[model samples]
Target: MRIYLPATVTELGDPDGLVARVVHAVTPALRAALPDEDEEGLEFAAQLLAADDSLDLLGERPDAPLRRVVVAADVPQEAVAPLADDDAAPSAVRLLTAVPWSDVACAHVDEVAAAEDVTAALAGDEDAADRLADRDLLWFDVGELARLAAGHE
Candidate 1:
């Protein structure tokens, strides 16, 4: 169940805080969407967050407002595909808004990469274990992402 959560950067105040908050916000949504999810699913989500640095890929676009939070879980690829599909379940990646905790504006990214990076990161985090596991979600603050994209110039 690889899931990519694209949230308004405002929800994430700083880079370090991004990961945890993202996890908190996305987990419940995912759980609600797939209530039957097990421990393996949770671990997979956590692994994805720890592995990839979403800030690096978005680039340094000054006008870009939101920070993208990427999450991945180990589920059948078929199950995840429809969620990521452009035409189906458009709201699969639940959106959170007007969060006072965030310091940035908007977060955006390529849905495919978000999903791939999250899955790869999670898989690597688990050391490519075969067993299904639950893990924390990955979060990248938009402020930090923008800064990183700007090369801290």
Candidate 2:
């Protein structure tokens, strides 16, 4: 299955060995939520999942205004499993297998311009969340993950 996992540079690795995790998007639940939507719409829903995850990241690190980081990966269906979290978003799932760095194919992050709005959204401003939602996450090649993650590492 191809899942988009919301990640941080620190999770990507700092001192060399950190297994990326699965607060990933694009899961069965998300598909179920919008059965009639096209693939593009589905992908957008996954991005929304990532947006929510980014707020989670803010909760963990109150000072970070960095854009949300989402890494797109391809792992076997068996590798991506459900987590026991009734409170979690429908797209939320667990990654049962370790994601080899090679499995990460691309990334989605906030545009630099979205930083201030993201900060406001992180602070619980609902309107800011809407504004932030309007901003698309920028894409980059997988190789740039290191440099990108390094910012927080």
TM-score, every prediction: 0.25, 0.83
lDDT against the true structure, each candidate: 0.36, 0.71
Best by TM-score: 2
**Residues 49-148, candidate 1, lDDT per residue (tens digit)?**
4223343233333244323344332233333222234442322432232222243333333322244443443446444222212332334444445554
Model 2 error, position 107 (Å): 0.4
Which 10-residue window of candidate 1 scores lowest in summed lDDT? 128-137
> Candidate 2 lDDT (Cα, whole model)?
0.71
Give, for candidate 2, the lowest lDDT window spanning 10 residues: 13-22
Clashing pairs in 2: 9-149
What would the TM-score be for candidate 1 when compared with the true structure? 0.25
Reference-based lDDT, residue 143, model 1: 44
Residues 58-152, model 2: lDDT tens digits? 66876554677777777788876787888877887887766777777887787767778877887889998898878778887877767766673
Model 1: how far is 30 from its true place, Å? 6.5
